[model samples]
Target: MNSTLPHLGFGTFRLEGQTAFDAVSMALNAGYRHIDTAQIYGNEQAVGDAIQASGVARADLFLTTKVWTEHLSRDAFIPSVKASLAKLSTEYVDLLLVHWPLNHNTVTMEDYLSSLKEAQDMGLARHIGVSNFTVAQTEQAVDILGKRVLLTNQFEVHPYLQNSKVVAKCRELDLIVTGYMPFAYGAVLKDPVIVTIAEKHGATAAQVVLAWMRQQGYVTIPSSTRQVNIDSNLKADSLELDATDLADIAALDRGHRVANPDFAPEWD
Candidate 1:
């Protein structure tokens, strides 16, 4: 994983309409060069619009979007990426990810990985990766991808679901870990420890949580619809947490996960 990439990114999950567009614009203005979106989010076009509206050069930005679970097959994956590119109004994405480990219509590891390779070869996506994948599944991807593909695994990681095992495996394999839901879907904002730390650092609870993940060498994308939250989220990048602050937040772990859908596999 290249440490050069921005550790803090903008997440466009559950955001839609003019709110999503405005939030993305605010994020861009707040110095967020990385934007994480997905086909399922149905807001790639808005993200594209925001990028264009921001006047940021294509090369200066790191745009990531995912192939939906329904489009994981070899036959559908490449075309799906093309569709995403069209929606995003870009020729290539900085990173393209498989949104989930399982496909609705049954896709093998080989099938999905081969399609990812094809997407890369075609120059449709600059990098290939996966999201919501477990350690075993990521291992399977690495084994199947061999030396040709670089697999970045994105998951919901926060203080509650620290995801130590997956983070360790990713470290060993040199894969980038994108930590989504870094604020635990706003649940961690109310913690007294986080609030106290935020007050001491002159930051928000969200910034403290995001800064903790960034300090751990994981990429974090925390979503926000409000302009204040969007601006506050970007401040996480400049936040420096001491060892004691890290320990305090780390102790808040309760093994809670906020984004587990019924179709998603158990993360270990």
Candidate 2:
């Protein structure tokens, strides 16, 4: 629950073309200052266009982009970040992250992490961290970076896939945990327990889950193409969950993760 990162952020994972542009523009208009995108998302330009069109001062925005696996090399890291900056239409990203750890040993931790630090030193990135990294990989990143700070370890955290092991490791390392896919790609929206809570609170199941995440003191970025949902997700911050609601949601964890790719590292 670090105040450094906005508690509720707008995610641009699958959004593209006019959808990406429109969604980002709506989010900015709806008061979402934190926007998360990555090179792999292929929507940075659209996101940038929306940011420019919104007329929100650059100083008021918190923009984040990730370095793709292919750009983890010493040679490609800095240049790739510059490309992302150009696409984002910003001189520096508020946060930069290693999107994922390489499945093979093609890029060493030392090389990529040093390159990440170098990017920050060069003023291309204001902060840096990792995503989809396992406990061991997170440890190695901290060791490699030494005194330099890793702001947050962003991975999947939701009612169904709590990912407590990695979350604990991040806590021990002093890295804030940013939970993406907080609704498990809409899978948790139909859960009977969540539904019951939603009815009790007179809120949507999605809002119930997002409020639970906020009560647990974790940052979550839930994306939506609908204007109502974009506005409603941010309103979860105002929804208060009592102890019983918190306990019910905590018991919903079933170790079900939804973001596993072939290249994902071993889970903790």
Stretches of candidate 2 exceeding 4 Å from the true structure: none
Candidate 2, residues 137-206, lDDT tens digits: the string is 9888888886338998899999999988888988889888899999998999999999999999998899
Quote the lDDT for 197 in model 2.
Answer: 92
Local distance difference test, each candidate? 0.86, 0.91
Best by lDDT: 2
- True-structure RMSD for candidate 2: 1.0
78-173 in candidate 1: lDDT tens per residue?
888988998888999999888888834377878887888889889998888888888898787888887436657899888888988888887777
lDDT of 2 at 168: 91
Model 2, residue pairs in steric clash? none
What's the TM-score of each model vs. the native? Answer: 0.95, 0.98
Off by over 4 Å in 1: 103-105
